[model samples]
Target: MTALSIYQQHDRLLVAVDCIIFGFDGQQLKALLIKRSFEPEINKWSLMGGFVQQDESVDAAAVRVLQQLTGLENIYMEQLGCYGEVDRDPAGRVVSIPYFALIKIDEHEEELLEKFNAKWYALDKVPKLIFDHNRMMNQAIERLQLKASTQPIGFELLPEKFTLTQLQNLYEAIFESSFDKRNFTRKINSLGILQKLDEKEKVSSRKGAFYYLFDRDKYNKLQHEIKKFI
Candidate 1:
């Protein structure tokens, strides 16, 4: 047989992409879960996912899944890993690549979420999911924690301009622990990746905390030499 015929001789397995979507709502880290529309496990909580099309790459499939479910594009996403256990999917022999995405909580389209029966659950309170999705969620959280410490990726979950308190709250939510205010502030300032503005957020206090913007340009310049966030 020809080379093309030889490759086609093997059994075919399906491939799918699942997204563990993460967001921050000022106080806690949240995950977006949808009620599965169809399957052996219909109406069950699951991560947003779809089968990879023949014409598209896995990365493209992931982006398509997120945009279709959330109606938001240009998101911050990273591949977590692949899961290819013999029976991970009950319906078929399918290999799944899971990706973790960070999105601003308020930026997602509300109508799309409602259409998909999607809801944001605090990471600590996420209910049991269908298939191996619960395992996917746990792995995504672990990856986010590691990424947060070594990189400034947590900012992707926050608003464009945020107070230091808001910034700390996000980190605390990700790590599921509290941080000392003085130490956190000192470390943040030393990075020199933030631009402090004269504007202040007065909602939480009379004195008000100043707002700061993450300077991507500055961070890009200093990324090689920057210290761990925690």
Candidate 2:
């Protein structure tokens, strides 16, 4: 049989990409969710997703879905896993590739979120999601925790300039555990990837905390080295 003839005998399947967009507001880890607009499970909370087009790769489809919902581009993203269970989707036989992205919450477009009726839900308090989305989200969170342990990927969720306290809070929220302030500060300082700025953030207290910026160049140079901070 020819290439086209052999492929024609196989069944056609619908492929899709689902995104678990994570954000850190300096206090809590949040996931962006949307209430389903159309049927099968109408009006239920779901991750942002879309059908993959014939011309686009899976990564491209994920980026497109994220951009459509958040109005942001080139954010940090990674493939979580594939969900191909036979009865995962009620509407049809669909194979979904799940992706997780970390974005600065303050940088996303508020208008797009409002347009899509999407809201940020704290990781610990997210509602029941439709289909296998809950499993996808749980797995995504696990992957994020693992990624953060080895790399400074968590910085993607924070602002360009932030206090060390904000960074510690983000890690605590992600791991859902408390870290001793002194130990956490010392561990972060040992990383040597943060540049202490002369400016101080006076909003929180009379004795303001010094602002620090993540040095991307230094981090890049040390990318091959394994660094762990918990």
Candidate 3:
């Protein structure tokens, strides 16, 4: 029998990938969500997702879904986990692979987002998501927290240059707690992965805070090194 024929006796189920796109807009941590356009839960808030095609891997499918909604490519994404409860999807038996992506909020294309009815919702203010998405989001957040503590992945959410306050705010938003200013600054300085620029961000205040950029060279060299920020 052919390979396809050999699996004829086995059950066939749809495989889907759901993306939890996280963004930090200087002040708050947000998630990209879309209002479902098709049944079985039309008009409800949901994570952007699509069924995997025969020719594509789940990773490719996840990237496609993220690109379709945000018109972005080469984003920082990671597979959160798999959700395979037999009846998780009401329309059919769909096994879902969830991914969490960190993106700069200001970098997404507005037109593409509008096309998908996509909007950024603060983590605390997000509406009830369809399917097992709420669970998926919670898991993603936990994973993000763990990853941010050890990795510099959180830098993906900020702009190319940011102030120390903005960086501190991003962490506070992620962990839902405030940090002591002195200690937080000291910890970040200890990493030595940021390059302080002469220019300042004047938008937040008249005096403005000096801008700092992530030193990719230093970061790459220190990838194996772990530092605790939380």
- Residue 224, model 2: Cα distance from true site in angstroms: 2.7
Report the number of the highest-lDDT candidate.
1
Residue-by-residue lDDT tens digits, candidate 1, 1-230 = 89999999999999999999999999989999999889779999999999999999999999999999888999999998999999998899999999999999999999999999999999889999988999999999999999999999999999999999999999999999999999999999999999999999999999999999999999999999976877
Give TM per candidate. 0.98, 0.98, 0.96
What C-alpha lDDT, on a 0 to 100 scale, does residue 165 get in candidate 3?
A: 96
How many pairs collide in each candidate, listed in order? 0, 0, 0
Candidate 2 lDDT by residue in tens digits, 1-230? 89999999999999999999999987999999999999989999999999999999999999999999999999999998799998999889999999999999999999999999999999989999999999999999999999999888989998999998999999999899999999999988887789999999999999999999999899888777745656
Clashing pairs in 1: none
